[model samples]
Target: MAYTTDFEKLKKQLNFKPDPTRPVSKQASKNTKMLFEYLKSIYGKKHLAGQQYLQSEEVEDLVYYHLTGKLPAVRGYDFMGVSSCKKTDDQVDRAIKWATQCGGIVTMCWHWYAPNDMDDYSKGSSFYYKTTSYDHKTCFDLCKGVTEGTAEYEFIIREIDMVSAELKRMAQLDIPVLWRPLHEANGNWFWWGNHDEQHREAYKKLWYMIFDRMENYHKLTNLIWVWNGQDKCMEVSPDTFDICGDDIYSVKEYDHSSQKQRFEYMTELAHGKMITLSECGYIPDPDEMKKDNAMWLWWLPWWREFVYKREGYKPVFDKDGYTVINKKYMTEDFMKRVMAHPDVIMREDLPWYDKDKHKLPDALSANLERIKSK
Candidate 1:
């Protein structure tokens, strides 16, 4: 497939100004500030392509690279390993490796299993409310969890301390992380969301508590908070998060239409802050996104079965014991096209790859000026 100049013409047609806002964290590290500025610089003009990895093995990224010959600029990692009691350090290590070696941006989310309530480690870590014996009615009390000198408080604090230690490791190395916790709170799948009004208030308290403890107590300035609560009722305080986003997965396999409606809804919820397609199945077509005026800061497609078709038990082996490379939510051709689009920023296109520099590259600065001039 050949790249086209049509996107260049489209870029000229769309007038997008760079966001001059700094990160929400007042004491954010130099790299964190640079990452936020870079994201703002490309908003509405181009978007960073991303892929989430289930583990540090790089299976998902390898599959994407095999199909597109280009790696995603943003690499998504999960802190579920700590919650699950498996590979606790590997996820953090892999994120650091991506930032240091691969020259890619790092985004992380936590699948926080209920603290002190691992009813069945048999099936591994269960972050879902229904998977465990977590009863929001009796067994769980968000108010008690936030209060000091209580059993509930101890449980949550212990977990947060563990995760904080991991985050501090990155901060020590000057790595900026797009930290997204308590994701999909509006959907109610996770223990943090889909609860009563009191619990909802407690959820916000929990967010604030985490922010206070991490930012003030732990002194972790490398984190750029990305809020993913999809509903207005579940939205965190505007000052608490640096960016807000929504997770949308299309049921239609080849649906490449830009999710402009959700984008606009999130934009309203963002309160002047930048918005993103935090998690997605089918990457919206770049041209469609430009036409709809809903260019997200970035989009991260889920792992394994979402990215590639799996016929057998494992993602690698098919029913006939053959290697599977067929596309699933996105077609192979569309994946190539999305990666090859001029408006999509890949790993090789990132301006802050140089570890020594703390400023925007001249090319990106020039592009920002060009967009502003239009």
Candidate 2:
């Protein structure tokens, strides 16, 4: 059965409603809408927290500590193309299985480089950014070839196939993925960014191409596509994405107004799609987020280093002058208390992914009622 059927059915079971004036009904991908309803069912009652772990060695310890009251509600992984070629899927598979078995949400971000670039010249330069204007036409053309089925199309297909193959494998095990590829396109860091009017069109087209190819050609139904929210581009194609993801790295002074404005613009651009603070420099105080009326579906700090840095946890070097982190965060105890709040949803709080029912556990009914009462 299609995963979307279960997703839609869950929405009905929860009796979810859209913001009447700013309705996002029918605009989100089916899976995205379903997931949004699931989160919305408990919006004020609980918040889903997330974090990224770039390496496998970090996974077990991170997940264990978080579950013991030190982390967020979700686990994140990255597909960094720091090498000349793409990374292997073995690690990806391991992460998915580990997160799924523990009943936590799995989120992925791709730091994919332009296909043509190699790390031949500089000491540490990678394939993703070969030149100053890496986000220029050459990169766009490489992606466009897939749509046109040109010579470069084979390479494009190969890259996408690598991703699709994994999704297809996960589909068999009935794992759902919060897939956020080509993120932060509005910024100029990667090849997909730094676009002019023409580049903007190319970006949109590339997004459409990926969606169509993955959904239609690859037959990937498990993904809930999340589009990055940036003011740079005009609103993306309506059907191209399921959610609008915003990354807040600045706002050191806790700029609630700026945060609110960003959310408001994203909401307008989304036109009924769900909006999430997908990444943050600092975990917005839950109270602050509630006060600003900018409740994100979830937020993930950049893992151990950034999480500690943002919280002002000073790093101590060892005898050899190497930094040693015996304590990941100074606010560890404080964060434990914060996450313990009834308004925060931890991994243990999630329902089982009912294989038989093809949706969430039946307890969701009572859970919804409980949230409503709050």
Off by over 4 Å in 2: 1-36, 59-71, 81-84, 117-151, 232-234, 251-258, 308-330, 353-374
Q: Write the per-residue lDDT of candidate 2 for residues 89-110, one digit (tens) a residue.
A: 4457655654555566778787
lDDT of 2: 0.57
lDDT of 1 at 351: 73
Cα error, residue 175 of model 2, in Å, equals: 0.5
lDDT for each residue of candidate 1 in 4-95, tens digit (9 for 90 to 100): 12334433532343233877676899888988888888888999999887743344554555566667899898887775344455777778
Q: Which one is best on lDDT?
A: 1
Name model 1 segments beyond 4 Å from true.
1-20, 84-89, 115-125, 131-143, 317-323, 354-374
lDDT of each: 0.74, 0.57
